[model samples]
Target: MNRSHLGVLIRMVTWPKKVVFGAFLASVLTAILGILVPWVTKSMIDSFTSHIDVTKVFLLVGLFLINVILSGIAHYMISYLGEYTIYRLREKMWAHILRLPIDYFDNNSTGQTVSRLTDDVSTLNNFVSKKVPEFISQALLVVGSIVFLFVLDWKLTLALLVMAPILTVIIVPIGRRLYTVAGETQNEMAAFVGKLSNVLAEMRLVKSYSGEKKEYTRVMESGDSLFRLNLAVAKLQSIFSPLISGTIMLMVLVLLGYGGLRMADGSLTTGAFVAIIFYIIQAITPISSVASFFTEYKATSGATKRLYEIYSLSEEKVDELDEYTNIFDGQIRFHNVSFSYNKNSKVLQDISFTAQPNQITAIVGPSGAGKTTLFHLIERMYTFDNGSISCDQLQIDQIPLSNWRKMIGYVMQDSAIMNGTIRENILYGVDDADEESMVHYTKLANAHHFISSLPEGYDTVVGERGIKLSGGQKQRIAIARAFIMNPKILLLDEATANLDSESERFVQTALVNLMKNRTTLVIAHRLSTIRNADQIVFLDAGKVTGMGRHDELMNTHRKYADFVEGQNLKMAQ
Candidate 1:
């Protein structure tokens, strides 16, 4: 809010020479044309006293019309420059947000980040494009006016300068309050957007719970807060604007009375009096523009502060090596790996295990036993606190994030599906995917038959989050996506846990095809998944309790035996 805000403003402005030069040219024309009109008016008035000069009258009228045209041109150029600046600024923010570390997203809401990127940045665009240009031309007019006023009569110019300090004393205090209010309004706006996005995304849950009134109340409170802040701004402007105008009018009245006496004594000519009136009237508009520029700048600083925090954040480290290593064929080892979210008590403690190349490593435990947290760690969605997870001989963090992630293909319990054609979903992160491979992978995943049966086949649009497709269909689509990725390490996190018996069989079959000859990690409660794992690592309260094949664990570990028996997994025998 202080000197630091200037840095944010400077960063937000984009200077394309063509646009900058155009705005500058138009601004100069606006100021020069404006300054000339009043001087032409003075000449017309003086000529009227002697004899009516038609040419002078026509010239004065023409200058006024041209001034209007120049003003319009200045506005258009400035506006174009503003929109261009915002477009580039948004591009940078979007890119930076994508590269930002996972912890940033873990701590911040999408609503707040999106609000800064879109709405808050718009506030800055308005100031830079519209307000700053106006201030510049107004500054020129004000300076030009003062220089001429001193030339006309130095005594009167000094008298007008006395008002500056009084105006400053009034504006400074209210400006601080306005800055605080503006900040609160922006924050409330972000909260409101976040709430609505969450509610709408989960609208089905809300309807089933009959919680409409509760959500309405929460949303209304945020809206009410914004309204109050906006009202405060309105009230401040109502007082701030008129108070300055009244002072300027009082100065004008004083000038008129003094000039009238001077005329009576023949000390001032009629032409000089008329000319002074013209200059003062012309000076009024730019003065108000100058005042508002300062006041509104205080408001824009709030938005600048929000964006400043985002820009200051460190991005995820990605150092691409000279070559991509085929590291997945080597075993993945967790050496005393421990982690916690927000430094709370550890979620995983001294956990160590290994998954060999091209084998199924299943993780199983009760809910809240840090089962899914294990997958998150292996994917490097979070960094562990007290240990090292390495592929081959290199620590995972030492490997470039891109290199590490490129080897992984994850399919979660709830399929991640965007609203797009099935082909697009299958080819989501894949590059240069051919139509032939698309069909081949879908066939491998057992998806080609159902897809070909659909009227549009692979071109069919899935509704948001694949809502139009059943659970098994979504799973097959995800499996097809995994197949296309051809990753070395495939992660299946309870991929078949939610499907019905019939759907589970089909999806299970597809998953077996997808997992074949890949270093696979599966987190499951399903007996079928556990029964097939080459190695089953049992986690109890974040500690490694058993590590063996399912049959070995059933004989050696009573907890594993009871857990599987409770699910009626014993009946399969």
Candidate 2:
């Protein structure tokens, strides 16, 4: 997009060291063969004027054949090497993307990220694999032609040199402008792609809301903006080829006039004049190719910027462990912890609590009272700003995230089922889980009976996000998944919320058994759900207003008492 950005691209190409070197060598060979053929052509032309020697003409023809064959081989190798290098680069870039932190994906759009991985990578691929080699070959040809022309006669070479300064005044500025436009176009295109992805992912929601016309208009507007930006870039690039060819053609005309006078004065030979003219025509190709090279470079510079932007995202921290084991003793603690999703507004403040070994701790509050946020912190989704959290006396921050997460089993209100068979979903967390244990947890979750009714049983496909199953069915399957993991600590976020009364009753019975001899934290809206909890913590506006057993809180705590009464009345109705 700018000078520094162009410099960055040049540096990017050089990263695949072997490919760049091979390209350089191939380009040199190709240019040499190209220049050699022109000399042979001149020799063959000159032979007709004199002795009419068959042997000399045949030798020139043979040399020309060798040049063509060698050029083909060099071209093939250069292109092959460049493509190979780019393939490896694409793989490496993908690997880098996969290693990035979860927060990065949370911030970026799936469409924009996918576009960068696909379109941006493709642009860079073209630049490195094809254009880079061609640019180098053309550059060599231009330089060699100029040197040879000077050796033939200095006056003609001086005439060509006069036009070189024009590049600074015209081509440089145009290239700069093209790069700027191309960069803007790429950004706009990515944004449009992002919008498209958003719409596609939420197409059901869009249709349900009856916003099709409004959404279509917004998409069309984005497309129009992209088209306009691309048109501007194309227009700038279109001006270059004709201008380059015209300048070269003008130089050719001037050379023919000036050289004729020189030949008449007997200062230049007829053979040299013809050769110089041929060189001028040949010069156009290399000069124009060099211009195309810069143009392509500018576009790819934009792509490289986008690619590097993804590569530069910070990755999650990883720690080396020589030996490690899950040592959670079914206990958890929170001491003076404070948290906020944003700096200005705290979602949790100065909260203190503990879940004893083999006990159930339920959290209940009004909506937006930070109930869900507490479970997130306990799971170490985000570290607290003040105080500490410990799992069986181990500070969470000291242990690796992977190890810490493995010790806890979580079942949320919305069932997250990946696209896979029932068996795979049930054992997603464990490696090579035993079938005996699998059947055990499925029965415990009240899912085995329903799954057996399916034609495929445990092998039935869940489809995307478990769309194949009903709400209550999906929830049971999720519970079964978490149940099979056999985690030391269990976190349930309204686990039975999706079920009908019958399903909820069944799931509640399963949960009561599952909570036995484990540290259980439950976030509940229904008083019936948390009525039997060993300890109930009542939250309101980021503050813990009450803490006790459900009956104790209902009797003594005003907020908990109101919540239970309201829920009971709703259930009664």
Candidate 3:
């Protein structure tokens, strides 16, 4: 287990001192009350040797009544403390995961990460709410019982003490192995969850391909792994009960037999022997708990390690040059820019270009030419390996990530709409947007008429990834979303590539409205749409091969001229 993560988890907790103190007080009082009972029973039984004092009998009944009352309060108070602690810990864990870099999500599946939050956290919560307070009182009870037994008959206490080492020898190795198995279980459970989520989320594709049986078999592989681990745990647990129970029975038999002989010889009083028996019964309950607690603690420690690892991850850092955050003339310049996901797979080379403020600058390239990647760099979704991308002469990386992203509105060719109402989708990021503004923007994007046609109108829920809406409707909804931002920069990545001609015309009109007075960067496959662009950048094999107006690129760059000629296109602008 990563001990450092344990420290980090502790610091993450938001402790409410009053509740903690109350819970602790209750637990201690309960343990003390528990200890007093056997002691009181001893007094009552010993009194039998004489007159059997009525007052002592009454005292035992009163103690039982008070114990019952305190037990109720203790259970509730301790549970409340545990629940509240887990709540705050989960809140911290959630916020941390959200703040982590996008790459974390890219590497980890939704199921895997969700497992960390839901399953692993629940394990830790079990330890906190149920195990910890239980262990505390159980430990106290066990210790108090042993002390009383020693005073009654030191020889019997020695026999019990001899059993301790033997039990330790039995339990320690089992605990270590259980810890290992438990950790394996957490990992297998995470993988199973990830696989299941992946299959369900894309069930349409599975049905389309007729791969239902194959997917099920794969999911079952993970399920089988989990089952095997569970079986291993059960086998280990099965060993525990019999070993501990046998040891306990052996102790009881010794007390009865040896203690009987001593009483017969008049060396031991009947009342003292009876009291010793009561103490043994009382002690056995907590002793069994102690053994199980070690087993449980080791198992829970596996989950603790997982919790620690998640919280230990480094979050995304943003350098907030506040002065430059909102300031933009939207002149984007790329100088000696180079980037790659890794060393071998270079996506963008030493690229340089500038998109002027309030002008539609188009980047035209074939597939795999890194056009979409350039847009990601400008949005600061990733850091460029070399060179600089800047807006109005200020390097983008120097600006805060949120602030930089806020300045631009990106509408992809296949823009995703979250599962929500049309109104919520349109105004997703704009918190303060009113209904009037949302409606106005929807009208500008040519989205309002269709939205109003629906029975629920703006209140209608767009199914997962906007499945309820057509390609054109989802596109226009995205446009309206961009309009709400009123951004200085707009990125349109083949925004009409997937739409029909009729849908394109409606979306084009909305795009025209959205593009007005914004610094626009467009990545397009068809050269004709961007023929009137203020500047045309031709990217080929991850390098800019052409830069200038369409007419000029046709005259100077061979590839650009060949592309235009290949399309049998007329030269414009």
Off by over 4 Å in 1: 1-3, 9-14, 43-69, 318-330, 500-510, 571-573
What is the Cα-based lDDT of residue 256 in candidate 1?
Answer: 86
- Better model by TM-score: candidate 1 vs candidate 3: 3
Per residue, candidate 2 scores C-alpha lDDT tens digits across 146-192 of: 87788888888898779877754667778778777777777777888
Query: Candidates' lDDT values, in order?
Result: 0.81, 0.78, 0.82
lDDT head-to-head 1 vs 3, winner = 3
Q: Alpha carbon lDDT of residue 208, candidate 3? A: 100
lDDT of 3 by residue, 227-316 (tens): 999999999989988898888888888888888988999888776787777778768777777888788778877757777777778977
Q: What TM-score goes with each of the models?
A: 0.92, 0.89, 0.93
Best TM-score among the predictions, by candidate number = 3
TM-score quality measure for candidate 3 = 0.93
Ranking by lDDT: 3, 1, 2
**Judged by lDDT against the true structure, how good is candidate 2?**
0.78
In model 2, where do residues sit more than 4 Å from their true spots? 1-22, 52-73, 80-86, 319-322, 434-436, 456-459, 512-517, 568-573
